[model samples]
Target chain A: EDQVTQSPEALRLQEGESSSLNCSYTVSGLRGLFWYRQDPGKGPEFLFTLYSAGEEKEKERLKATLTKKESFLHITAPKPEDSATYLCAVSRGGRSNDYKLSFGAGTTVTVRA
Target chain B: GAGVSQSPRYKVAKRGQDVALRCDPISGHVSLFWYQQALGQGPEFLTYFQNEAQLDKSGLPSDRFFAERPEGSVSTLKIQRTQQEDSAVYLCASSFATGGNTIYFGEGSWLTVV
Candidate 1:
């Protein structure tokens, strides 16, 4: 079965603190890995998509790196506005549909001023 | 719509009552998806539609859950005989193409079954 797991269910950091969130997955054939940020009462917003192992993408203060079995979302100088639930998802290729994403239980982050 | 939109942002239903949730995808989006999200948990896929055709309903928990996208633009998810276990947020998402990976989501509809 394909599964995705995120470590450190929650994290607290002061403004300007940098940290990384881990997401590990087990899939039949890796196709793509995605990162999203969700705020309360709203749907998730896309951050980045990594297609292959050793691939990386960056946006603003966030960076996403992918490997065969895991992905990391690194935040640099995070601010309170950046506090939100970070989610990681993966898609399986080959005979399986690549459009459907299996997501991990998100890691909630709280950045204090 | 500028983005995906779900109607009835909040709903309270009796245990045996039926409820219908609606989703309007972004204009010209070819793919639509439905997901159920429990509090503190990630969203779980419920169904998928490409245009007006229902492609996958494997993620639906039971037969009582039905979804349809008759016109390939707007969709509805109907739950028959709601149960306490059905209490969660129903999310709707759409993407530019049926086979593309990127999807955009709407603010979910919160359902409370009592």
Candidate 2:
């Protein structure tokens, strides 16, 4: 079975503070790793997708990096608007389970001005 | 139209009643998905559709939970004899191609079974 685990269930940061969130997983064959941002009442918004170890993607203040065992979402000089729950999901390469994503219990971030 | 769209942003149902939720994927998106999210938790996969074909439904909690994408563009998820545990936000997502693509989600339908 594929399992995803995220660290630091919650985070609090001041404006301009930089930090990172972690997502570690164990899978038979890792097809992809995804990062999403979700607000209180809305669904998750896609952030980035990392396919292989050493892959990275960036957008605005967020950067996502992947390793064989884990992935990281780094927030640089975050503002209050950057506050949201960060979710990590994985898709495994298998005949029957490749279509669905396995998600981790997300990390809720709060940035205060 | 612009993104994945879901109907009935909020719903409250009594136990033993039935409810249905609808999802319209983005234009030209070939893959659609349904997920259930409990309070303060990440979304859990419920089912998947590829061009109207229900390819995977292994994550559905029970037989009472059913989903269909009849026309390959819009999908409906129905719950029969809803229980209190069924209370959660049901999210619909779509991707242009398949599993490896970025999936965009709609504002979920919040279902509260009491």
Candidate 3:
């Protein structure tokens, strides 16, 4: 079975403070790893997708890096508007399971002003 | 629409009732998905569709959960005999291509079963 676990269930960071959120996973075959931002009462907004070890992707103040068994979402100088729950999900490449995204419990981030 | 759109942003149902949620994916999107997000938890995949075909529904919790994308554009997820455990935000997402493409999500339909 594919499983994902995220660390720091809740985080509080002051404005301009940088931090990193961790996502650990165990999968049969890693097809893709995705990052998403979700606000209260809203669906997840796609952020980044990392496909291979050592692969990295960046968008504005957010950067995502992937390893063999884990992925990290690094936030740089986050602002209050960046406060939201961050989620990590994975897809299986092998044929055993269908195309379903297995998601982590998520890390709730709050950026203080 | 520019992004995936869902109807009934909020819903309240009593036990044993049935509810239907609608989803309109992005124009020309080839794939659609349904997910359930419980409070303080990440969204969990419920089902998938490739065009009009229901490909994978392994994640559905029970037989009462039914989903369909008849025309390859709009989809509906119907839950029968709702239970308190069924309360969650049902999210709908769509992608232009298959698994590798980015999946855009709607605001989601918050369902509360009493």
lDDT of 2 at A10: 98
Q: How accurate locally is residue A46 in candidate 1, as Cα lDDT from 0 to 100?
A: 83
lDDT sort, best first: 2, 3, 1
Q: Who is ahead in DockQ, 1 or 3?
A: 3
Decreasing DockQ order of the candidates? 2, 3, 1
Q: Pick the winner on TM-score between candidates 2 and 3.
A: 2
Stretches of model 3 off by over 4 angstroms after superposition: A95-98
Query: lDDT tens digits, residues A10-59, model 2?
Result: 99999999999999999889999999999999999998999999999999
- TM-score of the second chain in candidate 2: 0.98
Checking candidate 1 for backbone clashes, the offending pairs are: none
DockQ of all predictions against the true structure, Cα-based: 0.67, 0.79, 0.70
lDDT of 1 at B45: 90
User: Per-residue lDDT for B1-114 in model 2, tens only?
Assistant: 998899899999999999999999999999999999999888999999999999889889999999999989999999999999999999999998775888999999999998
Name the runs in model 2 displaced over 4 angstroms: none
Q: Give lDDT: candidate 2, residue A92.
A: 91
Candidate 2 is graded, for docking, as medium
DockQ-better candidate, 1 vs 2: 2
For the predicted complex of model 3, DockQ is 0.70
